[model samples]
Target chain A: MARPLTLYYAPFSRASRGLWMLEELDEPYALRLIDIRKGEQKRPEFLAINPAGKVPALRDGDRTVAESAAICAYLADRFPDAKLAPAADAPERAAYLTWLFYAASNIEPAVMARANKWDVSAYQASWGGYESVIDNIAGAVRRGPYLLGPQFTAADVILGSMVRFGVSAKLIPNRPEFTAYIAHLEARPALQRAIKIEAEYVAQLKT
Target chain B: MARPLTLYYAPFSRASRGLWMLEELDEPYALRLIDIRKGEQKRPEFLAINPAGKVPALRDGDRTVAESAAICAYLADRFPDAKLAPAADAPERAAYLTWLFYAASNIEPAVMARANKWDVSAYQASWGGYESVIDNIAGAVRRGPYLLGPQFTAADVILGSMVRFGVSAKLIPNRPEFTAYIAHLEARPALQRAIKIEAEYVAQLKT
Candidate 1:
């Protein structure tokens, strides 16, 4: 048997992206919950898995990968049969990697700056500014049924989760493009399964 | 002959990471300078290449990849003959991709938060905290001649650039590990070439 895949996860956290990715991959995996509310993620044992002490760290037997985008990218590439990512040699792979990094590199930092009211100069910040980041996502999704046209790769899982979370948190303005994009993602059975699984986990935690 | 590779670069900007990556790949790529100080990067023409309007956007034939880490990842994967990254099927690829995403996802944002003195909670921020971020780098580099141990991969280029820039700007503490890591990277002939090319460009701008 292949090494069992395990995801260190916590609901109401960025780990949801990894959870959604797993569901989309339609792969068998074990979810090890880390309770962020109880500071369980910050505990030593958890930190051993991911030095960052964050959830969504995926362990495949001996190897562990952290960072939400990285986990998604790793999983996508690992299970090429899922067709969740373009082949490495494919021409579209350039744009594919770009959007994956863009979600973490640009969107996350820009959102943080905006939410915190940080006065970082647009020129100085690698992300430029919140408006530009949002605008770029809006433009890309508008041009998309997916980020790289018709194929909904792992880039969508990473970027879509960010946009969905941002709009829900009121951190990102609910532009028509974003709303339409989120609505489209909502229609996906994989995402629907992810949402249900997350709700079930959250419900279990409360009781 | 393969299609030409072009680096849309700006001196003293994040584009230097792309330059270093290109040098490391040992590939012939044209450098297209964008003067950020004069706001040439903000021009409509440049924005068409990278919606973020940032430097270090790399174009391979008809494809353009932006974000410094993304550029490095793309180049490393596209030219796998250089062995700058592990193959998709290689077990080492998990840690490799993790470190690539961690550079942008963790290191950059943490540095920005620290520089701005943004009052984001350590737990709330995806990066955890500036201290943790720096500590992780220190711990990783101390365990390495490179991030993934002896084999020098693109992760080194992305993370090393952040740590090196961080130390130079005094944004990151001058820990011995960081200094040593930067020193090791400094010894690279590729990095040396990139630095000389950047200096020449900056000198020309002055003249």
Candidate 2:
């Protein structure tokens, strides 16, 4: 029997990354949407599930997973038929891990810094200067239509979500490469479906 | 033949986490120590391997994995026989993924903020303030002998490293739980072995 998966998510939060992955995998999951505006994420019940009280927490049977990148990696590995990640022993697995962590550690922090307008000393910051991170990302994207080249893996899902968010927030300058990459990712049927569903959810909340 | 694994590292850097994991794996690996103070990580040759110029980048054959947590996860998955990670299909895998990402995303950032004495609105920060991050960590350890109950996994390597670093920097309070946890982790033969080798490297460089 397939274990049931429950995702505690909020619309337009980082949880969307995991939602997109679930769509890509075509897995049956129950989306228990928590409204961050209502302070639902800070409720004691929610805190028990994730002491961090962040959105996009996943529960599979008795196990709960938080952190968008970790959730995505876990799903990809658990559903090997999706092939969203390389096999553990496959040589490509190293690159797979590299990009996955890079998306979270490098790209995410860089975006946050830009969004918050935080002044960070590049020498002490692990992601280097914001410009360096941006240049590195552009160089990587210039290498292909996807982060790992032709084959789209789970890294693309997380990276795509981040890029899309950045572009929407004007955090990433509207460069030709950024525009093309976002378009390429949005063209994915799974992402389109996820976005559509999220849009409907948002619309429902508005009414 | 097993694929070659090489770690680009320097003693006392965050890369020590990767070195500790390599020792735990008991796998044959070449350690190419890069002295950060000498700007070796910024050299063109090393830059080609990791433009991020971070220590603890792992090269497995033609593929390179960076970010200490990512490298730890990759190695655990790559050498499944080491049982450093929960089985991909196991529900506990979610817990493993959660804490692993937590170490990087939450703990690392919090430590940096504390170390740099950066003051920002905790509500505005995604990490939910250093106090919360520390509390969450202490809560997790108090539930321990390990992050994942009695079973030690790569999450421990990641968390253990952060805990040790945090305590040393006085970022985390030296409470009994924190002290005990660090002692438990440092006492591990693998960590001891890595530390011993790193101390030797540091001492050699001094002369």
Give the number of the best model, judged by lDDT: 1
Candidate 2 residues B45-99, lDDT tens each? 9989987777879988888898898999998988889989988887678888889
Give the docking tier of candidate 2: medium
lDDT of 1 at B31: 93
Model 1 lDDT per residue over B1-207, tens place: 654899999888889999999999867889998988888888999999987778889989888898888888888889989999999888899889888998888888888888888887887778878888888888889976789888899999999998899899999999889888898899999999999999999999999
TM-scores for chain A over all candidates: 0.96, 0.94
Q: How close is candidate 2 to the true structure, as a TM-score?
A: 0.95
Candidate 1 ranges beyond 4 A from true positions: A1-3, B1-3
How good is the docking of model 2, as DockQ?
A: 0.71
Clashing pairs in 1: none
lDDT of 1 by residue, A52-114 (tens): 778889998788899999999999989999989989878898889889998988887788788
Q: Residue A150 in model 1: shift from native, Å?
A: 0.8
DockQ of candidates 1 onward, in order? Answer: 0.85, 0.71
Consecutive 10-residue window with the lowest summed lDDT within model 2 chain A:
A108-117
iRMSD per model? 1.0, 1.5
